[model samples]
Target: MFTFFIALVCIVFFFLFMIGLFLTIKSAFKFFVTKSVTKKQLLSSVIGTFLFLLIFGVTAVPTFGNSSDNTKKVSKKSDGYDFKSIKLGMTQKEVSDKLGKPSSQNDRAITYGNNTLYFADGKLTGGSPKFIQQQVNQKNSNDKQKKADDSNSEKSAAQYFGSKSTQKLADQASYVPRTQISNGNMMYSETISNVKMYRIDDYQTGVTTVYKADESKDDGLGAILYQGKTVTQEKPKTTIVY
Candidate 1:
């Protein structure tokens, strides 16, 4: 809304500036031809033109600043992720070292939300099969299936995001941050090591989204970390008077 207001103001100022310029030019032409133009008319035209131009230039600053800011945001978000970097044979310690502690852990598996890593002899085995397979299945499916699969991958990969450690990870990676609203939900997003991440609030089931930056353009979702119930509100009930 603020952006829209600034744009509207810019348009108004630009229109005024153009009109003032035209009038000033016409006054100059008339003065050159008639050689009897009043000083008041010439001075008023010049002043009006200069004033409108100044106002337009001032209004334009925020417009250009916003464009530059949006460009920077896009550039920051365009970064790529390589979740495949977390290999099958990586040690349990190595996985923990890379992604931080799991939300829940046991002898055979360590979990991040619904995504889990299985281990044999303290070495990493597997996690996020849907996400891993997305690249392999990219060409064999239709757009609808691809989108469905991507949504699933998002849920699976989301296990790694929206945690306390994720904030640390973003800081370590020097990722840029931004806040925006989508579908009436307020979201906070950041570019992390290998994914684009989002945290959103106010829904029946809050879901954090972790996108493989190169392929997924969908903004990340959810308010809470994966593996936990997010904020929810029950519908207000109405009772009939007895």
Candidate 2:
């Protein structure tokens, strides 16, 4: 809206400026071509042209500043479009009451801009896949670091046993691998290192662990991390009141 207002102001100023400029040019031409023109008339035309330019500059610069301020205000509040009143386990009708109808929706979820809210059992179960992705990456990094530390410890033990701590184990394999799954609530995830990571919506609960898939399994050493998000809701209620 501020943009539109600024544009309108510019348009009005543009037309006014053009008219003033044209009149000034005509008066200037008359002053130069017609010897009868008075010195006062010529000075007045010059002053009028200067005033028009001044007005345009004054109006335009402030609109730009105001437009910038409006942009800041909008960015700060855009999240309020759908976050403040929404909660986990609200029915779709309740969600609509709070956030209005989603821009698009399907049986399981709805989308607003880049955000997506998923549901299971007919209630707003969860959203924020991005947060889940962050956890997956963090868990894998920790897992890989653990594998390195373990490798170093083994080398130190070998050196103590009078064996040369030569290099990485022959079984050292790919980078840490991970996977993920989410529903209305927290997710169920499995990282290649054999650690599970997930978070609740409010982020009030957190657990930390390092997984070693290679060490935990029959494999010798190394980590592979694959990732995914799963949507699950328990006893999903499908009906919506109103």
Candidate 3:
């Protein structure tokens, strides 16, 4: 509606400018031919031309400026995710109500807790085959990470003499388990391993281990790191323990 109003205003101003310019030129030509150029006629012509140009400038400037603003608004709307109302743990229905249906759904899951929802345009679309595939992928990735940690723990334990020391070593070498959360536009990974990682493909920022569960205290190893490199690394390796 606002757009239509602005466009209508512009069209009206454009026609008015054309008419004013035409009259101004006609008056000037008449005065030149008759050799009776009156001050009043010249003033009227100048005023008409100035008014037309002024109106044209006014209409044109806002049109260009408002177009940029409208572009931003439309872009946000088309992205299928509203940043304002989104929150973690929102169900597919809730997200749909806020963002409407997704443009496309692929094999992706935006997982939180036991409830896994389909991911499309950074938001949860619904539960379907694509969602299931994403769940399987996540489970597979988690399983692989668990196995890796176990292997590393076992290796660390073998290097330790006593069983108590082995257990401690195993715990120390384990990577922090993370749960994925998103603003529908950005993904964040939270873990009790004293590290909070945020990832959007190659762009990542987070902190390193700072707390130990057994001691229930900070380990002073807490360090923040920003990954400026792209995350286009090779596909993750997986091993099935069974």
Q: Which residue runs of candidate 1 sit more than 4 Å off their true CA positions?
A: 1-8, 59-70, 80-242
| TM-scores for all predictions | 0.28, 0.38, 0.38
lDDT of model 2 at position 56: 70
The parts of candidate 2 lying over 4 Å away from their true place are 1-15, 23-38, 73-82, 112-115, 121-242
Residue by residue across 1-242, what tens digits does model 2's lDDT show? 99999999988877778776776887778877885667776776876698678777787778887997988888656544636566666777887887787879988988766667888999766776454345446667898999899666544432322121112111222321223325332222223222332222212232222222354555222332222222122334599899
Residues 180-237 of candidate 3: C-alpha lDDT, one tens digit per residue: 3353222223232332333222123321122112233352222223323332234446
**What local lDDT score does residue 14 receive in model 1, on the 0 to 100 scale?**
75
TM-score of 2: 0.38
Candidate number achieving the greatest lDDT relative to the actual structure: 1
How well is each residue in 1-242 modelled by candidate 1, as lDDT tens digits? 99999899878877878777777787888878888778877786787678667876776767787997888887555422335556666777777776677778887888765567778888665555455355335534666687787676666556635443434544544453544466664454554444566655444456444334433335433333245434233335799999
Could you tell me how far off, in angstroms, the CA of residue 107 lies in candidate 3 after the best superposition? 7.8
Q: Sorted on lDDT, highest at the top, how do the candidates line up? A: 1, 2, 3
Span of 10 residues, lowest total lDDT, candidate 3: 158-167
lDDT score at residue 127, model 2, on the 0-100 scale: 73
TM-score head-to-head 1 vs 2, winner? 2
